[model samples]
Target: MTPSLPDILVGNFLCMAEPPPPESAGEFMAGKVGVVALLSLLAAQEAERGPSARVWENAAIRAVLTDAAEAYGDAFAEAGAGVDTDFTLGALDRANAALRRSLIALHEAVETAGDVVRDHAILRLYGQMADARRLDMPPLPGR
Candidate 1:
């Protein structure tokens, strides 16, 4: 059976990290290896979880926009109505990017209007976005 993308990334990370690189390669090379290994690990996580996380974040942001539309404007309602049937990472990311721009505008509008309730909702959504995108970073070696 063919190995998954995450599995391949893990394999690459192992190959780079094992034997700890040559001592002759010095600190710079070791540092480079560490960086590449970290990237590989992060990429693996994204490969497995990125799409779902983005979808959830997008939906949550849209919900906030929809609810705020009455106080803000119909533009927010229209923005919230957007759908990403493509579901490809790139497509979803594009839709997400646009929605994020709208979200930012809505945030500014709420703050400017002193709409505490909407502002709090937007702030909560921001926290959720950060949590959704958080990486499962492995602890440094030797504690």
Candidate 2:
């Protein structure tokens, strides 16, 4: 796969060595620049995907909610619906975590819906959720 230009750029910047000048380039060369550059790159990627990620993620959440709502229509479940797209970073993040947890529940519930087709669909959804949360959460559901 071709590396993203941003990644390539960050990689190049990170590979740069000290100027070998004043010799006073001491602490600054202690990986501080690399760390900051990587963080900046991460922030850039996050910003680029910020809106779309929330949109796609919320749709996933809503799909799960709707599926669960219909499956457990009377199961007294709590759906984390009505997410405001304009929420602050921290708040949106908290909602993201909550939605992820619910995704797990919805995935299992969907699988056990007593229908083969829906069961397969839920299995795929579970896979997608695993892909999305693989970095932060465990790969297995509920683990």
Q: Best candidate per TM-score, number?
A: 1
- For model 1, residues 1-143, the per-residue Cα lDDT tens digits are 63445566777767676675466388877776787778778777887788998899888888888998898899999999966688787777878888999999999998899989888888888898988877798998867
51 Cα displacement, candidate 2 (Å): 3.2
Task: List TM-score per model, in order.
Answer: 0.79, 0.55
Tell me the TM-score of model 1: 0.79
Return the top candidate by lDDT.
1
lDDT of 2 by residue, 21-119 (tens): 566477766555656565555556655655455556666776656666765663314564575566555555667667767766666666576667766
CA displacement after TM-score superposition, residue 55 of candidate 2 (Å): 2.7
User: What's the true lDDT of residue 72 in model 1?
Assistant: 88
